[model samples]
Structures are given as C-alpha cells and as structure tokens.
Target: MKIRKIAFLITFLFLWRGVMAQENSSSLAFSAYTDVYYSYFSNEMEPNALQPFTTVSPRSERFGLNVAQIGLAYDSQFVRANLILHWGDIAKATWSEEYNNVQEANLGFKLANGWWIDAGFFATHIGTESFLPKNDFLSSTAVATYNEPFYQAGAKLTYEGSDDFYTEFWVLNGYNRFLDNNNAKSIGVLFSYNFSENTSLTYTNLLGTESAEGSAVKQYRIYQNLYLNTVLTERLILIVGGDVGTQSNSKLPNMEETAIMYNALTTLRYLFTDKWSVTGRAEVFNDRHGFISGLIPTQNSGMQGLELWGLTLGIEYKPDPNSYIRGEARFLDLDDNAALFSGSYSRHKRWELMVTMGYQLDRVFGF
Candidate 1:
C-alpha cells in the first residue's frame, strides 16, 4: 500500500507540472550577442585616432571587443516588451552619456488593425549602416552613417497592415539622445515599402532642437535620411543611401546663413558561395560650412569644412547561420586643402585594416 501511494503522488505532481507549463507557454526568448575584432590605422597619431566617427573596434592596431549584449523579449496576443543591455567600445563611444549602458528598454501594446504603440529607448530608424558587423555587409560603417543618429528615447506609433508598406511616427527627447538635453522635444517619421522579398526602400526625417539648455547657440535642425536595398542578381546585393540636412541660423559670435550638409554612399555585396561573400562601398560627405564635420583648422585660422570620400572592400566567411568572420581594407581621402585630423599630424589620406568575428545566441532560455 505504501509503494502504491508513493507512485500515485509522483504521477499527480507530474500532471500538475505539465498543466502549468502549458498554461504559461508564451513567446518568451533570451538572446545574447558579442563581437571581437582587430583593427589597424595608418596614422596612429592623427586626430582620427578617435577612430574618426566610429564605434566598433575603436582601438587601432590592437584587439578589442566591439559590443556584447544580452536581452529578453516577450510577445503575446496583447502586449510585448524588450530589454537589452550592452557594453564595450560601441557603447562607450556613441551611446547616451547618462544612460550609456542601456541599449534598449521598451514596452508596446497591440492596437487596432496591425498598429502598435511603444515607448522607451530604441535604436534609431535613420541610418543606412548598423554598428553590428553581422547586420551589415561591411565590418566598419561608412563615414556618412557615422554622422547619423544611433539611439533615441521616444514614443512611437507603428503601422504594419496587410499592405506592402510600413510606417512609424515618433515623438522624442531629441536627436540621438536618451536624456533630454533641452526642454524642447523632437519629432520624426519613417516610411518603408517592400516591392518584393528582395527589394525595399526606407525614408526618414527628423525635426528637432539640438542645442543644449544653457548654450549660447539655439539651433533648430531638419534632417532627412533615405536608403534602398535590392538584389540585382541572385548572388549580388546592392544598397544606396543618402542624407541631407539643414539647420536654422543661430546668431552667434560668427553668425552666418543657414547651414547645410549632405552625404551619399553605395554598397555592393557579391556572394561567391553559400559561405563566402565579398562587399565593397564608396561614400562621400560634404559639409561646406563645417556645420557638421567642423572647420579643419589650418596652421593659423579655420579653413573650409570637411569634404571627404572613402572606399572599402571586405570579404566574409560564415561558418554557420549565426557566426561570421570578416576581413576588410579601407581607404579614406580628403579633397583639396581640407586636410582632416588635428595637431601636427593632419592627413589627407590614410588606410585601415580590420578583421572581426561575431556570434549570436538566438535563443538560450534559462542559461
């Protein structure tokens, strides 16, 4: 009788556990990611030693960790949430100074007709390139992408109906900020359309005040971003992107007319095999007034704003669906007397080499 009673108790507990597991089965997942790389620069003493508008692998001529992130996501019939935290060179260089470690912490709810409302910090929908190497064709970002926003704190309304188009409207603290730099707010929108499974275009714009609270200058900025992704052949991919922006004249000590800047780039990736691919990019940036790139200081006074272009070629080897090893060589040149960098080490041209390895843990629950 004692043995029978023990067996019955065990069976009852197993049934109860199965019922609880079924009842709590929701789309919850844990994700982790990391990338490490080695990069070298031609002029180690130049001011571009800050890596010249870069985040990943900012350490030159040495091995470094680009970024390491871990997060949790949950989605259900009515609600969803995401929380991601990161550390490494990417976070230190570009993330918000106050909330530097928080990559994303957002919550959302489903609304009528494929619409959703979300609030909190988010990766900006503005740029053509990504900081994550695996997400982009190249290991390093273009100079144009470096000037674009990387992160934002905001509330957004997103619409993704049955049509091929998707749109998002945002109200935010300010451009590229997690903390409100001033009392004023910013707004923006993004529109994306998919012509086919292999082709799409995205357009984005931002209107906001970038000046700090106590600063002497008060500037209102209007920025536009656009990009397209398409496959010219089964083995070849192409991307073209551009950015144009203008700011209201803030009458300062050196007042002037409205300031304007533009950037453009095109990238191509050719796949030689299922596991091998080569990617190349050409890019240019023009900021005539030094509004964005700043005036290149000559021996005495400030010269023209930056006018620069660059070329990059990279090869990638994918060992699996979630891991990649990449090698790239890049060349950057400044035109005319607009030499870049500072101090006694100004340079008109330089070369860079980088090799990176990346992996993602798509789902590793309770680990």
Candidate 2:
C-alpha cells in the first residue's frame, strides 16, 4: 500500500507538470524565504515554554527560527498553482501537527466567464496580518490576529469582473480545519473595494460549526473580519482592522445563549528615509464570554472573561527590496490580571522585545 501511494503521487506530479509545461505561455517560479529572531519577555519561563498570543518569534531568552520555506508557483493564462513547504518553531507551535510543514498548496483555473475557482489549502481571507514576517508591521501579532484563523482548506469561487470591486465565495470543511473535524460544512465570503490607489476597505466573514461529529450539543460559530488601509501622507501609512465572533454558549439547546468576542487594532508606519521606517500600533481584545480566548472561569469571577490592551513600537531597516531587519517592543495590560488566556505562561501585564531578520529570493522563468 505504501509503495502504491508513493507511485501514485509521483505519477500525478509528472502528469500535472507535463500538462502545464505544454501551455503556450506558461510561467513558473521558485521562491525561498527565512525569518530568524531573538526575543526577551518579562515573565521568566523555561526554554520550552510557549508564549501567549504569539506565533512569530514566540520563544523568549533564546534565538529562534520562525520559518524557513521553499515555494513554487506556476501560472498560465487560465491556470495557476502554488505550493509552499516550511518548518521551524512557528510551524510546530501554531500549525497542525500532521501537515504543519505544508504552509499552502492550491490549484486554480478560470471558468467559462470571468469567474475562477481554486481548491486546496489556502491562507485565510480574514486578516491583514499574514504568517510571513516581512508582511507584518511588527515582529509579533496583535491579539486580534493571534485569535483569528491563520489558514483554511476548501474551495474559493472568485469573481474577476472589476478591479475596483472584488469578491470571493468559499465552501470550507470547517473553521481552520484542514481535514474536516465533523460532518458539517462551512461557508465564507469576502468583499473588497478600492476607493483609490492608496485607500481600500475589506470585509470577510465565515459561518461554521465547532461541534464534534455526534456531540449532543451542536454549536454554530460566526466570525466577521474587517480592515481599512489608507496612505494618509506621502511617507506615512495607516491600517485599521478588527474582528468579531460569536458561538453558541455551553447552555446550548436549553437556553440558546451565545458567547461573543471582539477585538480591534490599528497601525501607523512612517518612513524617515528611503531605507528606514518606524511603526506604532495599538490593539485591544475583549472576550467577556471567554469563547475564543480560552479564559476559564475562576472562583472570584464566575464566567468573567479576559480583557486586555497592548501597544507596539518597531523600527525597520531595509538593505534592499528583498530583505529587512526589524526590532520591536511591546507591552500588554490586562483588565483584572486574575484570568490567564494562553495556558501557564500568562501574566496580567507583560513587556517583550523581539528582533528579526527576513530574506527571500525568487527565480522566475517562462516556457
């Protein structure tokens, strides 16, 4: 059986590559990237300890590798495919154990009209922040980004009718589920509008279930994400993003109560010179029902949730267009310090510092 499966995979790859290579104007590219960092946290913990609401540069008091990835991309007039393989602490700490090394793999083709369909694993369509280090303003993620879905699997139907207005419809296995947890299927949608070259707004949402296959209580979850980007000045950029989600309370069928969570963040970046820039960010999270943040109830506060605010400041230097070195400082404050969110490493208020350097190289060729 193992031999047969390996043979089948090899054959499928050869066939797919042969078909794509036969295209009249096919383009292919290979990409490599790596991000390495060192961090320090106020709360002292063991080297193996995990940080709260952090993925990039997660470990403290040690040098770490966030990600190192190799990617391949192919595109023809009507066909496109992308595959990325990665490893490091980011994958082990935040991704699925079974397929953590596989960051993204998807195939897409155009339909009869201006519509297109893509199927496979993909980055979630919810947040402005991404897993890639160079794409984010700070070295770490905000509370909103930490709680949001990072990746998803299924299919997307996208409309390419206009450049100013964009939309996508999704049929997913479940919320952030790679292999499908239950029999239930999920759905999502995204809408983006560009007012000008420098200003845009995006809204995306998902409706799904988080219950087990045959659990007695069926809980339905709804998540909403929104962001706005604008170039406020010649050398300054501003981005605002937020998330809201709700799930059926544990009470379930008896009372139909719901648990809601919401968060917001904003970032501003100012370029001081051609190769240097500074960024500042402010963020807040509230999970009164402790639905998504994993805030468990305590004796003093029955069912009270986790509420916190944080601020970040970072400076970045670019030696060239393909690489960056950034240093950041962040501080977080909790409303009541009594509840902890991310396992045993949580603290009421904490300070952290992170420094990372990222580099990427891509080679493009045409048939």
lDDT of 2 by residue, 67-160 (tens): 9999999988799999999999888767877688888999999895678999999888888677677787677888778778778899999998
Root-mean-square deviation of every model: 5.6, 9.7
Residue 181 displacement (Å), model 2: 1.6
* CA lDDT of each prediction against the hidden true structure: 0.84, 0.85
- Model 2, position 31, has a per-residue lDDT of 97
Tell me the lDDT of model 2 at 299. 37
Inter-residue clash pairs, candidate 2: none
> Which parts of model 2 are misplaced by more than 4 Å?
1-23, 250-255, 296-304, 339-346
Please, what are the lDDT tens digits per residue for candidate 1 over residues 1-367?
9999999999999999988776555687899999999988775654324576666777777788888999999876568899999998888777888888899999999897689999999999788888677689887998777778889998999997857899999999988888888999999999999999999999999999888898786888889999999999999999999999888673223555578899999999999998999999999998777666656744345577767899999999999989999999988888657555433344667687889999999873431
lDDT of 1 at 99: 87
- TM-score for each prediction? 0.87, 0.88
